[model samples]
Target chain A: GAGVSQSPSNKVTEKGKDVELRCDPISGHTALYWYRQRLGQGLEFLIYFQGNSAPDKSGLPSDRFSAERTGESVSTLTIQRTQQEDSAVYLCASSSSMNTGELFFGEGSRLTVL
Target chain B: AQSVTQLDSQVPVFEEAPVELRCNYSSSVSVYLFWYVQYPNQGLQLLLKYLSGSTLVKGINGFEAEFNKSQTSFHLRKPSVHISDTAEYFCAVMLTGGGNKLTFGTGTQLKVEL
Candidate 1:
């Protein structure tokens, strides 16, 4: 793809339900990241993937938040037992390499947990 | 550890006037600084970044920012503003030799009026 792309631009799910958000980064990019932005809050780091290495999962807020990436391509973020506080925009970004390079962002997936 | 702070939550300015958005960061190691802009219902777009060399950096849409190492600040500034410049601006920092994760500040809403 020309830029980072996210699927299901908007989602609404009830509390206790599970939601999955997908992201497809640009081709040949070796670094991908997931972030969340709650209403009136700053962007919070979720997870990061670099090449074929184990992801940097230090930013996941809780045990309910988990993510996976296939090699250096598509990534998915899964939230289990969602709560109203989970409402936010999920953002995906990719960079040419993992050396603090310029990032290309996707439009983001807006999730509304009811 | 690295964290960014955008001091002003909202800044209003008249058209054609100059504007500045303040940002500061705290980090134990070297870091990279960046500014991103977000229009309504859209994702973030990279405005500029400071990696190495000169402190002054120019970005898209005639925007510029200066990185002050001593104060740990990277403030975005524009000599003159326009109505189209109204958007949410964010300051982000990435550890120079760390993973792909980035720490972002709470955004500053820039409102340009006639």
Candidate 2:
């Protein structure tokens, strides 16, 4: 079976630029999540979408970070006016349903802000 | 808000030796516990999860974890580790309700030496 997939395995951009990271969740998955992992740090929740509705967006560090999922399928995490602090790996995950307790993750998109 | 703690920032063990990574979580409600492994240049992989039924759960790559309710701990253990096990480990907890958002702890780097 195909697992989650992400685009642009690596991206190098200058500060103040905007970047978009894409994620393709597994087929029939109704739940999608976005997370960020700073260098030598842990995974931090960014946003979550369930069937096109974002029920939790509190984990998004700032307004500069935004994510959207359409029809419980592909998802995109966009960082506006990116800063050096936003240099990290953006991760995407999906589960079959709510409370499944297991999320399949995709190879993260590594963003380097200079 | 729920929080997870990885007591060890790094753990170094000789190949073929036993290893344990400690994890503790604090949450107001019952939650799902998970352990994920991230190899260099790869996505996070689900090691094991403790949702319900049994306190002990086994996962891929000879990994296992035990969920403790009273102590609020879910520690991962492997009797023998290979150099291939060298990677970063993260402990996470997701609330039973409230949209299945994950709260992750600072990662622990496991170095398996030959």
Candidate 3:
């Protein structure tokens, strides 16, 4: 793909229901990251995956939030028992090299937990 | 650990007026600085970055930022502005030699008025 792509641009789910957001990074990108942006707030780092190394989960808000990436392609961010506070724009980004420091981002998945 | 700080929550500027958004970062080691812009209902786009070169860095939309190691600042500036420049701006830092995790600031909203 020409750029990073994200699925389910907008989602509204009842509280406690599970929701999944998908991200397909740019081809050949070796680094992938997930972030959450609440209304009028800065992006909050959720997770990071570089190559086949162990993902950096230090930024996940809680245990209920989990993300997985297969190889360096598609990734899924699952929020278990979604809560109202989980409503936000979930963004995915990729970089050709982890050290590049410049990220290409997706349009983002707007999640609304009703 | 690395952290970024956007001093102003919102900045209102008139069309054709010059604008500057302050950003400060804290890190114990050498770091790379970046500025990203987000238009309404859109994803983030890289504006510019400072990566171990001259202190001044230029980016798209006539935006520029200077890396001030002494002050730990990477403030964004533009000599003239247009309504299309209205967007939310983010400051991020990535420590060199560290894992591929980016620490982001809370963001500053730039509202360009006529």
Residue A44 in candidate 1, Cα distance off native in Å: 0.1
Number of clashing pairs per prediction, in order = 0, 0, 0
In candidate 1, the residue pairs with backbone N, CA or C atoms under 3 Å apart (3 or more residues apart, or in different chains) clash, namely: none
Candidate 1 CAPRI category: medium
The recovered share of true contacts, given per candidate in order, is 0.75, 0.80, 0.75
**What value does the lDDT take at residue A36 in candidate 1?**
93
Native-referenced Cα lDDT, model 3 = 0.92
List, residue by residue over A1-114, the lDDT tens digit for candidate 1.
Answer: 488899889999999999999999999999899999999999998898888888889889999999999998999999999999999999999997644657788999999988
* Native-referenced DockQ of model 1: 0.76
Q: Please rank every candidate by lDDT, starting with the best.
A: 3, 1, 2
Which rank order by DockQ, best down to worst?
2, 3, 1
Q: Is the docking of candidate 3 incorrect, acceptable, medium or high quality?
A: medium
lDDT tens per residue, model 2, B3-79: 99998999999999999999999999889999989898777888889889999999999999999999999999999
Instruction: List the candidates' TM-scores in order.
Output: 0.96, 0.94, 0.96
True contacts kept of 2: 0.80
lDDT of 2 by residue, A1-114 (tens): 599999989999999999999999999989888889898788888888887564588888999988877787888899999999999998999987744667889999999999
Candidates 1 and 2 compared by DockQ, better number: 2
Q: After TM-score superposition, what is the CA distance of residue A77 in candidate 1 from its true location, in Å?
A: 0.6
TM-score of 1: 0.96
